[model samples]
Target: MRPSSILSGLSCAAFAILPCAAITVDLTSEDSIKSAASTIANGMMKFYSGNVTGGIPGLLPGPYYWWEAGAMFGSLIDYWYYTGDTSYNDVTTQALLFQVGDKDNYMPSNQSKSLGNDDQAFWGMAAMSAAELKFPNPPSDQPQWLALAQAVFNSQALRWDPSTCGGGLRWQIFTFNNGYDYKNTISNGAFFNIAARLAAYTGNQTYAEWAEKTFEWTRAVGLMSDDYYFYDGSDDTINCTELNHIQWSYNAGVFLLGAATMWNVTQSDLWRERTLGIWNATHVFFTSQGGQAAGQIMFEVACEPNNNCNVDQLSFKAYLSRWMAASTKVAPWLYDDIKPYLAASAQAAALSCSGGDDGTTCGTRWWNNGVWDGATGVGQQMSALEVIQSNLIDRVQGPVSNSTGGTSQGNPNAGSGGDSNPIAMPAAIETSDRAGAGIVTALILVALVGGAWWMIA
Candidate 1:
C-alpha cells in the first residue's frame, strides 16, 4: 500500500532476521555502539579518494570544498578519540598535515580562489582538536598542531575587519571574493570557537579576551539573537544592517562549544549563562515525530525538510552533534541534559544507513524510519559517523590541556604575516572605491601640471 507500510513489512522480515536491521546498535551496550560506529565510519570513507595515486592527500573530490575535507578529518579524529580505533588515524593525520599550507596556516594558496575565513578555521579547529586529544604528532620536521591552530587564529585576528560592521571577520578572506562584503556567523563563530578552545587548552587570557570580543561583536551586530539563536550572516556593505536570518545547526553548535569552553576556562557566570542559553536554543533542530521515531532526532533546520540541503548543509548536523557531545566534557553538568538528544539522533542516523549497494551508506534524513532516502556521500557518512560515535562521549576523558598532558608546541607569532600576500585579482579594480581613486588621480595630475606651468611663468 503506502511506501512506509510496504518498507515496514519487507525491510525487517525479508531484509533481515531482526527488526529494521540496517545498523544494529544497542543504546545500552558499549560494544554495540562501537561496532555500529565502525560500520558507519567505513561507509563514510568510501567516498574519500585522497590517499590514492594522483590524488592530493588533503583534498576531497569535486563538488566538495576543501573546508569540508578538513571537517571530515575532524570527525575521523573524534572517531579515533571515542572508539580507540586506529583504522583511520594515519589518513586523518596525513590529511591534516598535508593541508597546513606554505605558511603552516590552513590557507593553502590553491584554495585561495574560494577560501573563506570559516573555511580556514575548520582546519584550524581540527588541528586544535589534535593538540587537545593528543592525536599522534607529525614528525619533528613538520608543523606542530597547536602552532597551526595559533597561526590560523593570528592570521584571522589580523583580518578582523574593524573597517566595517564595527568589528567582525568577513566571510571571504580576499576582497575580490564574492562574500567579502558579508560578515557571517560561521566565520566569526569559528574564530570565537577556536579562541575559546585555545584559551582553555593553553591557559591563555588573550584568547579568552578575543572570545569575549567576538561574542559581543556578534551580538552587537545582531548575528546572535538575545535568546541565543544564531543566524547565517549579514551584508557588511550595508554595515551589517540586514541579516540573512537563515538558521543552521552548525552555527549554533560552533557558538555553543565556544561558550562552554569559555565557562570551563573562566568559570564565570556570564559564560555559564551564555552556554546554557545556546544549548536551550538548539532545541529547534530536534523534532519529535510520533511512532517508531518518537524521540527528538536532529535535522538541518534550514534545508532538511525541503530536501534541498547542499553538500555543505548535509554535513552541518555532524558538527552540531560533534560539538554538543564535546560540550558535555567541557561542562560536565551538560552531560545529563544533552545525553538523550545524542542517543536519539544516533539511533535514527543509524537507521538511515541502509542505502547504497553495500546497504551501509547513510542518508541525510535521519527520521526515515530505516528506509534510506537514496542519498549517499561523504557528508552523509560523516554526519552518521559523528552522531553515532558521540554516544561514547562518557566513555573517554575530556579534552586535555597543555598543563594536563597536551604536548603540541605553540607559536604566538606563527601567522604574523600570513596575510602579506593574497592572490592578485585580475580586473579587481571595478569597484566604486577604485572609480573614486581614478577621479582623484586625474585631479592630482591637473594640479601638478598647473603648479609646473605657474613656476615656469
Candidate 2:
C-alpha cells in the first residue's frame, strides 16, 4: 500500500466517516492533500444514497441527474488515481459498470428520454479515464473501459447532424427531446474531448480527423469566439443565426483539454497554437484585477458573482479544475502557467467545505473567506473535492495511450447495432417500471419547462 500518515492505521472501510472539522490541505504535501481529499470525498458521498433500497446504483437522488453522478465518479476515479486511496474504488467501479447499458455504451434505457449527448459523454469520459489511468478493470464478463468509451464515441458519431449548422451533435439525442434544435458546446466539446483522447490513446487517425472536424465546426458556428471564449451554444432552428454568448467554465475546460490532447498526439503547430490560445482565454475565469481573490481563485464568471448558479452550474468549476490540471500532463508547458491558479483555487475551495452537519460540507461560494454561505449539495462538495485533489496533478504521471502500457481493450464498431437508435418510449408505463419510462418523461418535461436548461449545462 502507498504510505500515508492519515490513513496509516485506518482500514479502507473506515474512510467513510465524515470530518468534524473543515479540510486542511498543505498544497505542498501529498499526504495533506490526500487527507483533505478523503474528508471532502466522504462529505460529498453523504449526499448519495444510490446503493441503498429505494435508490439506484449510478444514480443520485432528487435534484441531481444521472450525468452529474457520472461526473462525480470521474472525480472519484481521479481521487483514487491521485491519492492511492482505494476507499471508494468499489463503489466507483460499480456505478460506472451499472450504467453501461445492454450495448456496452452509456445509453441505458432508463435514461433515454432525458439523456442528452453531453450526459452520455460524461460517463464515457469516466470510462476513458479508467482506461488511461489503468483503474482496475471490471470482471472478465463485464464491459471493459476503453471499449465502453469507444462505444459511446461510436454511438455519438452516428448522431452527428449536418442538416442544421453544417455539422454538430444536437444537445439531446432524440428528435423528440426539447434540445434537438439546439447545438451546444458541451455536447460537441464533449465529443471532441472523447475523440481527441481516443486518438491519443489508440493512435487512430480517424479519431484525430473527427476531433479536428468538431473543433472547426464549433468555431465556424460562432459558439467559439475569436478570442477563444467558448460560448454556451445556439439554436439550429434559425440556421444558427443567434448565439447564447454566455461563457461557462466547463465549455472552455472541455475544449481546452481536448485541444491539448490533440497536440500531445499530433504535435502539429496548428494544434499547439489552438491549445495555447484556449489556455490563455481561460484567464477570464480567474480573478486578475480586484477583490481578495484577485487572480487567484477560479469562478464561473457568468453566474457565481450573482448568486444565481443552479445545481448543475455549481459543478461546472469541477470540470474546469479537472481539465486544466490534467492538461498540464499532456502539455507540460502548461504546468507553470496553470499551477498557481489551481493551487489558490484548491485553497479557497477547501475553506468553503466548512458547512453542513458534518462541518465539512462544501458551499457554492469559495470566495466567502471560509463562511459556509449556507449552501450544501453534491455539486458544492464535488467542486471542492475536484479542485482540492487536482493540486496533486504534478505528483503523478500523465495519462497513457495504447502504445504506452494501456491494457483496456477497445471496439471501434461497438455501438452500431440496435442500440444506436434512440431509446423507444414504451406505449404505457406500469407502476413497477415507473423508474424506466416514467422518470424519463418527467425529466423531459422538466427540460421543456425550464426551456433554458440547455444553458445550465
Candidate 3:
C-alpha cells in the first residue's frame, strides 16, 4: 500500500475502533507533516506581516511592548529554524532592531528600569535566538543583542536569593525594596532557557550553573500535590499562596522547553529527569489522563463546539502548540500527543474569517460574542500557528536527538563537568515526589504511549 493511503487507512480504522468522542489524527509521515507545518507557517507569516504593514492596526502600535516583541521575535526564529526561510530571519532582524533602537541607546533606560523579570526573561529568549543566529559571526559588529541578554541575566542572577522559600531567580526588582521580591515559575524557567542558550553560545559556566540551580529550585518548591501541575511557588504566605494556586499552560511549557534546552547543552541526568518530569506533566494536563477532562472538553467545545469552537481556543492552544513544537525537538513522542490538537486548531483557524490580505482569521473574544479583534489576539493566533507549523516540520524531519542528555555541548561549565549548580535544599521533602513519579509512570504505561508506537507507526 502507498504510505499516505496506509496512514489514512490506519487513521480511519483507529477512529472506528476507539470509543472516545474525539480521535487525534496522526500526520507522522514526513511529507504530510511538513505540509501541515507549511500551512501553519504561511498563516503565521501572513498575520505577522499584516501586523507590521498596518494591515492590522493597533496590533502592535509603536514603542512596542517588550514581551509582545519578544513573542514575535521568538516566533520568527521558530519559523526560521523549522522552515529555514530567510524571510523569517529578515523579519526577526527588523523586529529586534526596532525594539532595541540604536546601538548607543539600545533597550530604553527607562524601559529597563520598569521592566519585570518575566519581561526580561521573555526578551532574553528573543535575544538568545538572535545571538545564536549571529554569534561568533554576527552580520554586523554591534554587540547590542549579546550585551542586552547578558545584562538581563546578570541583573537577575545577582538578585537570586536562597532566603526565599524557593531558590530560583526572582520575578522582578522592586523599587522600594532593596532585596529580590517574588519569584514565579515562568520567570525562573525563562532564565534557565536563556542561561542554557547563553552557555551553548558563549561557553559560559556561569550561565550553565544558574540554569541548573534554577531547575533544581523548581523541582523542590514548585512541584504541587497533583505532581503533574507545578505551582508557581509555595503556599505558606498570602502572596505566595495566591501565586502558587494555579497551574498555567505557559509555565509548564516554558519549563519543559528550558529543561530540554539545558539537557541539550549539559547532558546532566538531573536535567534529563527534569525534562522527562515536565514532559510527563504537560502530557497529563493536555491529554485525557491529566484530570483536565473538563478543560479538554471545554477546549474542544470552545474551539469547535461540535467542531465549531473558534479562535478563542486558539489563544490557549497557542501555548500548548508552541510547547509541543519545542518538546518535539527533544522528544518526538510528544508530537503524537499534540497531533489531534493541532488538526482541530488548524481546522478552526481555517474556518474563521479575517479581512486581512492573507484571508487569515482573527482570534475570538468569548466575552464579546465571538468578536474578532486584531491586537494580542492576532498575535496569539500567529504564535499557535507557528508552533503547529514547526511541529509538523519537525515530524517530517524525524527525530534528531542530542547526544548529551543535560551536559553542555560546546562548553562544559567550568569545574562542574557541564552540570548545573544545585540550589539550597528544599525546606522539607515534599510527599509529592514519589506520587508525581508514579502518576507520570502511569500516564506512559500504555504500549501506544511508548517508543514502540512511534516505531510501529
Per-residue lDDT over 138-208 for candidate 1, one digit per residue giving the tens place of the 0 to 100 score = 88989999999999998888887766667788999997888889888999999999999999998878888
Shift in Å, residue 398, candidate 2: 1.2
Query: Could you give candidate 3's per-residue lDDT for residues 1-457 as a string of tens digits?
Result: 0000000011111343322121112344445434544554555554454345454321243333445556656666655555555655655665555554232213344455445667656666666555554422224544455555665565566556555453455555555532235566667777777676666556666677777666655655534333446654432232232333434456677777667767766777866766777766664333332232222211321122222222222333455556556655555455566556555443333323232333333333212122223322444445445544544544334222122322212212221222353222224323442222222211111121111111000
lDDT: worst 10-residue window of model 1: 1-10
Residue 104 alpha-carbon offset, candidate 2, angstroms: 1.3
For model 2, what is the alpha-carbon lDDT of residue 261?
Answer: 96
lDDT of 2 by residue, 339-367 (tens): 98898888888876765556677777777
Candidate 1 or 2, higher lDDT? Answer: 1
**What stretches of model 3 exceed 4 Å from their correct place?**
1-59, 62-64, 101-107, 112-114, 131-138, 144-148, 176-181, 200-204, 223-228, 233-243, 266-270, 284-319, 331-359, 362-376, 395-457
- For residue 4, model 3's alpha carbon misses the true position, in angstroms, by 45
Q: Write down the lDDT that model 3 would get.
A: 0.47
lDDT of each: 0.81, 0.80, 0.47
Cα displacement (angstroms), candidate 2, residue 135, comes to 0.5
Model 1: per-residue Cα lDDT at residue 231: 75
